[model samples]
Target: MMMFRPIFASLFGATLFVATVLPAIAQETLPSWSDGAAKTRILDFVKATTTEGGEGFVAPQDRIAVFDNDGTLWPEQPYYVQLGFILDRVKTLAPQHPEWKTKEPFKSILAGDLKGIARGGEKGIVDLVMSTHAGMTSDQFAKIVTDWFATAKHPKTGKPFDEMGYLPMRELLDYLRDNGFKTYIVSGGGVEFMRPITEKAYGIPPEQVVGSTILTEYAIVGDVPVLRRLPKIDFVDDGPGKPSGINKFIGRKPIFVAGNSDGDAEMLRWVTAAKGPGFAMIVHHTDAEREYAYDRESAFGKLDRALNEAERRNWLVVDMKADWKTIYASEH
Candidate 1:
């Protein structure tokens, strides 16, 4: 009877072990986000929307998440990539327009006078882009962007432009996709400029990207159909333009939206205003040690208005210094 009791106790202990281990195994198999409330909230939202019997269960088609490209997904420091392209363009075109050596914005750019360039502001940026990006066919523009991205490296990091992407953001993107979310890049950079490299860098295909665009015209160039880039601005995917771009390009409002600055305020507002369940987040760059950090005073990714709005709305504002264990994957 004592031997039988010992065997029974051993079997009971084994059963308890299995019961405890199986659930932990199951949970471990699930995609684990960074350790924090933000990760938990994101996982919870995704689970609620994807689970079969959950109240927020959404069809695969409706699982749309839109993310801002610059600053949100990657580092947009020293200025946006489009600005880099424009600066390079200025350098390239400088020889032809030697007068640019004496001009205000062009001269500032040629001389690498960043302070003078800063003084030019939004109007300066617009003029530079219009001058450089226009006159070429859309195909030419695409090829130009592809060539530039292949060669250009970030100034401070000395890494390829694509490699500067935020590591945690990439993980989040993959996790969302695994859970059936279709992620889209909504950016203020030119659509053509981003289309060539976004898929390789961010796991978002060209079809899922929306950005600033110039008017184009279809014409036959030597019996080949071509789209010529016109100087006319079709759209600028910043501020209010963001929501409009999403509506025009994606048609359906996104269930999840992530952005970094006041430029993305309207997009966040638009997503949160949808009739049903929605989530919005803003990445607050606060870690100067790991990566570049600036908020309200910075020209790029300025966060004042967005911070206030995020607080008022109870939106998640991820602090890079606090939330992230690391910044870029390359650094790790």
Candidate 2:
């Protein structure tokens, strides 16, 4: 009991609560979610999986759910939150590295040239991340990221970066945990970067997060042992890498997975293709009034291929405009 107890997000949690709990609790499960097929499907999946004797019933230990962070949990419009961090970090460290004044991506970043940065593609973004995110001890890097979140405000929302997580999704995390599901974040963003704010912003702890990571090694400094952050990337938990990372780090095949962009296509595919009952959903960006809406052609959070694949795979395509009652945490 000691070993399995901790893995369960909510012991005595799952379908029983939904069946026996008050109407208010049921309504509160996903308060920000509008009444629609999307909502119905999610609730139904939980019910089925938690109903013991039912064909869809899954054991408590098998109830694993994974989510993509940026676009799914919060807005990744204009630019990714991590990319925003990278840009700001470059500027912050620019005074220390005077050579960055004339560097390609660094120079473009300092000039506020999003177009130039885009021109460099994924390679350029990776380079920028390595430059800004590495060289310090792991603990030092985490502290820097935590400090950045404390003061960094979104250009569009004017809210702190930590304040932008989707309230509906936050509710969903609680709902799943209430239903005995172990929730984990498998995002493309840096693991260390996401770990700082995840537990407070969302309910997930640092141990449950799996994401892209740079290399790190143990070293003694000033009579203290520490894991030093290295510039070389160790793994990228996105696109095709998502499934591989999950297999490598998480071990268990998740029964539920949610994502927002093409970067999440393979993850959705991987989860839904499994032998048992699996549920996959894509948070489609469709509300221009409350949030930015673009797919297929958008540079950031493009949802083209996965959007197309949803129908064939029986995946839930959540229409943000029509399905969500509110967009941000403050909206509710």
RMSD of each: 6.0, 9.4
Cα lDDT tens digits for candidate 1, 1-332: 99899889989988988899777866551232357888777888888999997788988899999999889998888788778888898898888898888877898999889788878887876778788999889889989999999999988888887788788898888878988889999999889989999988988899999999999999998989989999888998999999999999999989999999999999998899888889999998888887878989988888889899998987888888877877777865
Point to the candidate with the largest TM-score: 2
Off by over 4 Å in 2: 1-27
Error of 2 at 101 (Å): 1.6
1-332 per-residue lDDT for model 2 (tens digits): 77887557465575556567866665665888998899999999999999999999999999999999989998898788888888888988899989988877888989988888877777887788888888999889989999999999888989997689988898899999999999999999999999999998898999999999989999999999999999898998889999998998899999999999999999999899899999999999988878898999998888899999998888999998888898777764
Distance from true location, Cα of 267 in model 1, Å: 1.1
Sliding window of 10 residues with minimal summed lDDT for model 2? 9-18
Clashing pairs in 1: none
TM-score of model number 2 = 0.91
Q: Each candidate's lDDT (Cα)?
A: 0.87, 0.90
